[model samples]
Target: MKGLRIIVTVKQVPDTADVKIDPKTNSLMREGIPSILNPEDKNAVEAALCLKQQHGGTIIAITMGPPQAEEVLGEVLAMGADQGVLLTDRAFAGSDTLITAFTLSRAIMKLGKYDLILCGRQAIDGDTAQVGPQLAGFLELPQVTYAEHISIEKGNAVVRRGLEDSTEWVRVKLPTLVTVTAAVNAPRYPMLYNVEAACDGSRIIIWGAQELKVPETMLGLNASPTGVKKIFEPERKKKGQIITGDPKDMTGILIDKLQELNML
Candidate 1:
């Protein structure tokens, strides 16, 4: 088989542990928070790089977010991706998974040739796990999700998927998309030289809505079918009553309390 042309979709997200919700906007408060490449996405990149190493191919890493999101592309490049593509625009803000998938599909189409597309099973911030399947639908390509292992031979890709109670192995024709779980493989750290080179502007490509030619109606929050109405931390309420008595009395009291709470 010829060398593979691989594409990996990635994202930049605020560190999940430090993420905060905005009470005023009912959205994630990303401002002033440190951002990093989505953890699972790093696995996807590692998978792509591994395949390229074995098959003599090129890997392109792509992501969509604000201008600052370019940092993710830089990281991917440092990790051995041959190219980095960023899709960013004011209009892409507030995009739900559907719109996000559609926009990514458009960018992939613009790339013209590719033998495989890889994605992380989910983003930590949203944990929706919807974008990969949605992107495959938009691109009209077959997809393998939650893949833990992938092997390619004779124009076909074989994947092992980790499921709830069992594992599944699937083989599909080339030019398909696969969403990978973190179990697939560990990602590599960038070499010192590659890290330096990744910072060079020439290594990254940037595209906005105008370049993508996406319809304005399909680009942002307006295109999203879901909306967050509000966000707030659930109030913590404590209720307790100590049955300070003999064991039998305490048992009886507990039973009564359970009944009062409709447990019986």
Candidate 2:
């Protein structure tokens, strides 16, 4: 059985726990921070692995970042992916989500035929949750976002969408894209036997901007109009006050405070 060909996109992100924002520019202060495989992308890979197990297929993990990003690809392969592709080049440096999606589309196009593309709902560092949908747009493929559960049925992908208030179920056509959340499945650790192959340089296929056949004009910063890339949250120095009272009294006090502040 020629298994499904899955293209799973992964990322190496600054561990958000230790990541901080530059107060001056209001962007991530990434210097000296450690990089780790994005948490959610692991769920994306797990989804692919489950599908492959259910219906024999090939899992190809892909990522675009500095060459150090290959480390994450190796981890993906160890977790059961058949192959890995690293997109690295000076041209792709400092790319925002939009440009990142375009570059990934180029790589995926180069990969030839694929049955499905899976991605984490969002990268923790950015938290914008835009790339998967954007890549789907570039590829002109149908997509389902915030997927919590996925299963193949009758040549279609049955997806469970986790929304803020309620759940939704939808069946999408094959050759589609789905951005999964951590709820999809717990990622399996890499097997010891696969560790060696995963670490070997020969297993990773490196591709540069030239390999993707993309032009300089369309590669990075110029591809996006919004030049600013920043995420900022102002520090709050105010202290909280505790109120010991009956429920009704507390509600009344809250209402009074809101009214005093012109916030009600």
Candidate 3:
């Protein structure tokens, strides 16, 4: 297990769930919006930690965001990760999911050998759900996505992948990439002692396009083959009418309303 290395890809994003768009710039006004670790990503960290606990190994959490995102790295370290890497550069800004995956894959490649890569199912802000698979594609490694659970037997990994109606069990050799979902397990907060250690020793490795040596044509906005055409606030839907009546009467009224709406 000493030679085994597990890398967890994490991100810091604005809590867009409660954020408001700026009418002036037609962009989200991230100012004052709290940033957090993508919730599903916490599950990824937990997965890596669990694996390290069972089989002695090093768990490295990697994130691509602004320099300030080192805070997120400290949090991950506090939670038991050995250390973290922060991929930051002005060129990395405005990256869509494709470029993001490419940047991470390149950084991981520079990080040397690893037995496995773990990532969350999706980032909350983008929700493209493409990065994990895309990184696997770029790495040309077999991937298991939407994993609900994982186990190791000898040097092989057995995973349960969520499907449309059921789950599929897949076994893959080491060095495979896997994306986990929230159903994996509850993430553990770092204890006070570990938190202090992390706060003192966490030095986020900041990688730029030059350091990573990834082609600029394959990074950031230019590297992104797609871009957001438009982003508009959703119109507020009208309040629903309350069907206040006895149970039988409510059922009848619902049926009448459905028929009136031609949805019956």
Candidate 4:
């Protein structure tokens, strides 16, 4: 694996589990919420790190977000990635999932050769799992999504994937892209020494549309084929009270309530 070059795409998203809707703008106010690496993406980095350990390759983490997203890239470096690239531009704002995938794929193409590309199953904030597969489409490369386990032997790779009904195994060729789920592996925490090194050595290589030499219509607002017309919060429902009693009595009461509500 000495010559293998890997790229991992990461994103910084608001901790949506605790997110709140801002009524005024009909948008999510993410300021106060703590930002975190998308859980599934951490699995992506861990998978790359594991590959590096066994094959002695280099890992580069790429992220597309605001300048502050560099923090997430630095964290990946601290975990032992070789380098990071930050793709930031005001024009990149308001990009939908399709635009986001195009931007990321362009950045990866700019970096040249890579044996493997890894990404998280989905971002917690958007929960749109399209980017990984979209990127594979853009790159014209094969992809394995929702991968729970991966093993590389010789030049071929075997991956176990999680699906709606059951798990299935897939065998893919080298130089492929894989999107991993949190079930893949537990990511490691950075040690004190690596923390210091990452702080000192990590430098994000920033790229713009021009720098990447991508077609103007292929990047930013001009290139994006999709748009978010509006963003709003969905209505929240209140939880119903639970009644605990003798099984026979509770069942009778529940049936009565359901019949009265026409839900039976």
Provide TM-scores for the models: 0.87, 0.89, 0.88, 0.86
Once fitted onto the true fold, the runs of candidate 4 whose alpha carbons sit more than 4 angstroms away are: 1-3, 23-26, 201-203, 236-264
Going through the candidates in order, what is the number of backbone clashes in each? Answer: 0, 1, 0, 1
How do the residues 42-84 of candidate 3 rate in per-residue lDDT, one tens digit apiece? 9999999998888878988999988889888888998989978
lDDT of each: 0.92, 0.91, 0.87, 0.85
Model 3 CA deviation exceeding 4 Å by range: 1-3, 23-26, 201-203, 237-264
lDDT preference between candidates 2 and 3, better one? 2
In model 2, residue pairs whose N, Cα or C atoms come closer than 3 Å (at least 3 residues apart or on different chains), thus clashing, are 3-56
Show pairs that collide, candidate 4. 217-223
Predicted candidate 4 versus true structure: per-residue lDDT over 91-206, tens digit per residue: 78766778888888888998998999999999887788999999998898999999999988887778999998999999999889999999999999855676676667435698
| Per-residue lDDT over 24-88 for candidate 2, one digit per residue giving the tens place of the 0 to 100 score | 77678888878888999999999999999999989999999999999899889999999999999
lDDT per residue for candidate 1 within 52-165, as digits (tens), equals: 989988899999998989999998998899999999999998899999999999999999999999999999888899999999999999999999999997888999999999
